[model samples]
Target: MLGQPAQLLEREPYISFLSSSALVIKQWLLFDPMPESDARFLLVDLRQRLPVVSMNDGASFHIADGEPAVASDPAYDGSQPTLIPGQLVPTPVWDDRAGSCNWDAKAVLEVTLADCPPVSDERVRAAMELYVTSQYDFLPRSLYLAMLTVLDGLATGSKRADRIAKWIDEKVSEAEEFNDQSLLDGLRGLKNGSHAAGIRALVKRAVLYLGGSEQEAARQANTVKRLYRVRSQLSHQSDTVELDLARATQLTRLVLNAVVSNPALLNDDAGEEASLAGGRERRTQWIAEAEVAIRRAKPDCAAVEKAIRRPLIMGKNGLLIAHLADRTQWAIDDGGARPVSDEMASEWAALDESFGERL
Candidate 1:
């Protein structure tokens, strides 16, 4: 038993390496254009024993311990997928199935270490990690949202700004000189002045710049936009949409592969693109700077508190909207400004005969 434990410890690194390589291969099967099926197979652990396969041609070949295999049968139909053996993976979290060993030698050769994006790039590495983690079947909706979050981080820019710049440029270039001042005056009322593209536009542009055709890029962008609505509903209203796991996962995989193939897609000369490494810090800095500016121009704490206490708006049902000390808006009724529901507000309003006068 002592010798067996020592031997297993010695082979642990080899087993780990194979499992890591299998993750890369699984990504290939998922996104490669020529792979007929992305179905996965079982890689049973043989403990300290080397796994060897005996072919029907009376030849045998040693396989990686983490290499997936299936029971040899003429009637094997690629169902009954299994997890990477020798690990304690939850089987229910995986949808992969066992597939045939009829390997496509050419496809295998097509993918190499060189084709893989360098792990040195933080964004590429992070995106790849997200891609791998997304394979878990735990809460598909959450995973889909998480995929979009990564995409949002990867695709930087303001959609509103892109449209405004395009429209302004087109109007100026194609104008008959008289409309120039009119356009300039019209621009003064613009809500967004920054030239950064929005999340949707950035996503589309990234896909297009990273080798996707115009149509494919547009489709991807549209899909993101639609899903973003679902994200908003889930976030703000606590609502969820029925998600097609395969389609959702495929889109994320395609976007992830594109980003991984070219990390430069995350770069922009204008510095509008958030740096993948210190992006959170940069965002925090911006918020801090904004707060400093607000503080510089604001009154004392007492005055601020007074202003917050004053109602900003009042509803017909006698619900007064005011900012709380923490800057959150709350509905204030007869119960005096607690975090209560609208129904409770209506109830409070109905109780008071002179509520209209108070409002």
Candidate 2:
């Protein structure tokens, strides 16, 4: 869309026009709140490049560069949030300094959460390592790949991404029909984010990790699914594509952080495929066991986790701990770093009732 930059000056009437009978300099001097010193500076500039349009009806005007004009009925900020002050976003990246050619540059990314958890430094580091410079094509998938590592690692422990696990099962169970052996192999490689269902599962899991409810996670999954759809267009479609890259990067960062910090979700294979006959019972029982364990453990790491940037500390038995902003202890999954017994689930379940009391 071609922006009407020529009419910008007319639209932004910050300057005051004082009319008079003659085209004399006195008419320009009588402008509202126009200091003589400031008017002289503007007058000098105007003489150099006379405006193309006629001030036939009006005498002259002076542009006030000092104070910003804020109207009582000013426009709303925007749909998105920005931390930067008075951030100006140019319509196009290459807009020039001239008002007719360009506009101001705005902040790159914006993220919002009810309780904004500290960003995961390790994940960022890992992503930065994989992130290709200057090329946009490989980065999104690379970011997704990093998140998938956490998802694949946490897949066994989650009750959330049941749909993704089921999708994986379906793909594997009937691979011949769709030439999906490669897809199956991809799943085997722990890169389950090759499809929409897997991506949704990862999204739901990430939401759950960030202290969100299942319903909320499901809702956010829709957004993740939509993101993947746009991502798909980049690879699959022929037409011109425009994506909200900043939003995508922010979201990917959020998801990657969730997965990185909560790797305990990776060790369990509760979401693995099962036969219709006996598998359903086992799956239900597994879910019930997980729920019972969760109720007993009552993990409060999220409540104390207000750290701006907590350095991950390795504790006894491969357990990771990060001291929160409130000086409370926030624990990471010990089993996540290494293989632990399935019976550890029972012990982990008993963690709330017995372990903390002993300590």
Candidate 3:
């Protein structure tokens, strides 16, 4: 899989392999005994790109190398050229229907892969793998767990862990100093200030550290608390439960993007180490600088809105009727409807309600 033809762009500590086509993993092997040995896998990416035609009745056909061409077609002006092997290559289609000949759901990812920065931190990479898996994994329980795992891994820092450890040590010392055995009982089975408080703190800190406004951080921290409750319900009550996958996915991406775009944020441990060495102010200074750097990297919303506001389409009653000359040919090629009526609006409202119910 690593040896396949791909755009291998190397950055310090990591490399990204961007493929123009989808690569399906056929087989894989794990070297458990020899941990240092390289892992091996087989990928199935290369294929003959064939022309396919789909009818309105849902019937479809693909023209391969051995297939005969329709010679006497009314749509043709001249003799049709013979389709030999390797004459055409598969390209991404915008269709969303499953089992369609040109179904490429990862098309957006493919287009953005080249622009994505290479992850400098291994933990962030691991969290990103989990995030991607959560996108496709259909099991609600698994998806919820995977996203929460990412939060647990990246949201919490070494300083918080160290503080918790110190609190535990303090409790032990108080028990010894006062000869209170009940305090020792309180210490038993206690971890990280009761899971709820610990997790909420982690989420709050992570959001603020990533340049999110205080209100936004508090709002997301509240969201995590709700998710944690759902997690508990899933573990203790039943195998299945109602979950908000969208919210979980959004929070996961937020943290992952912040770290990937600014790898310096992942260097929180350096601050923790310095604080332990009696330079506590350095950690505070480092965090301020990191937040400023990340904010600078973020896109300007006003500029983005101005750029995208092109006079590309002609609209009627808030519906796009036709493309203007400024619109790209690709946008004009697709056939669609711009239904603008009272009945259409009613039906759209119904659809929106149904989608909200699902979420």
Candidate 4:
């Protein structure tokens, strides 16, 4: 089989049958004899997650080594695999002894990672890195943290409140000179409004900086308010919120990309890198290429899309990898989605009891 022209059969059926959703042989040599060759791949949803055993029966495949004098590539050495192809003879029914296999499931990795733009801003790049790193665990707190970190980084370091107090001071001074009690009382709102630093105010500032209209800014600001409350409950009270992670993740990505486009928003001397780096250091010990790699992570699409420039090889301890699809980031062009709701919290992915422990 090795010498004959590579077979032209459906790659997905066999691959899927062998690889269930739970298993991944990261950095493994696929029955390879050339120990020095460096090549690796991502086999997504291949099989259910399985333990690292000496052998995974489903993943085994056979190829005829031209030298029939001995079985397998004699030049290399490895453990003997169970159930070699075309050599079985025992079965409950004499008519069939080939063992059993179903070839119906179809799944394939179609990579289409677009070229990453030149990331000029330090803060934006840091946020994107955090956002990508959060994907592998597929957790909501990570997504929430990603959004919070990016916003904290890009939020206008300048007072979130417009310098309305100055304008108000001038108006009050003028009214007092004329003894106008009406004007003085009306301008009292300036004291509280000027001090607003909550999510609504911050989100409005970010949206406006991104050139969004007042209505758009208000809409986003409201979303920020609600989501921030959800974030607070999870962080402080250990409460759960019914959130649609897919939609929420898309929204978070949009906010981060907007920050990347407008890096000047966080021109303060101390960038967000300190807190961000410290946060990553505290979490799970490992990071995956699929998590931090720059590419579109669309809603309902768990895979990370990226360009495969060269053969990627990882050691026994390496990041889990995935494939890219479509040229654009998912949902970037697809307009905004519905915000989290009571029904969505239970129906979609939500914070389970263990989420509080992560805090």
* Best candidate (score: TM-score): 3
Stretches of candidate 3 off by over 4 Å are 1-111, 157-171, 174-198, 209-211, 263-359
In candidate 2, what residue range of length 10 has the lowest lDDT sum?
307-316
Ranked by TM-score, top first: 3, 1, 4, 2
The residue pairs that clash in candidate 3, if any, are none
lDDT tens digits, residue span 137-240, model 1? 36677677777766766665443457676776666556546767777666543534333245556555454443333554466567667777677677778554
lDDT, model 3, position 199: 52
- lDDT, candidate 4, 1-359, per-residue tens: 12111111221122233224322221111222321211111111111111101011123322222221223322312222212122332121112213233422121111101111234455565566555544544456776666666555555423323577677777788778877787788775554532214335555544444333355546666666666667667777755676546544545554554344344434332323322332243222212333343333334544444312110111112222233353222111123222224453343223211111111
lDDT of 2 by residue, 28-59 (tens): 11122334455444334433222100111011
Whole-model lDDT, model 4? 0.37
Better candidate number, 2 or 3, judged by TM-score: 3
Q: Candidate 3: minimum summed lDDT over ten consecutive residues — where?
A: 305-314
Cα lDDT of model 3 by residue, 117-194, tens digit: 544466765676556544455567787789888877765423346667778777787778777788776664353345
Model 2 quality (TM-score): 0.29
Report every candidate's CA lDDT.
0.40, 0.36, 0.40, 0.37
List residue ranges in candidate 4 displaced over 4 A: 1-116, 157-202, 205-212, 267-359
RMSD after Cα superposition, model 3: 17.9
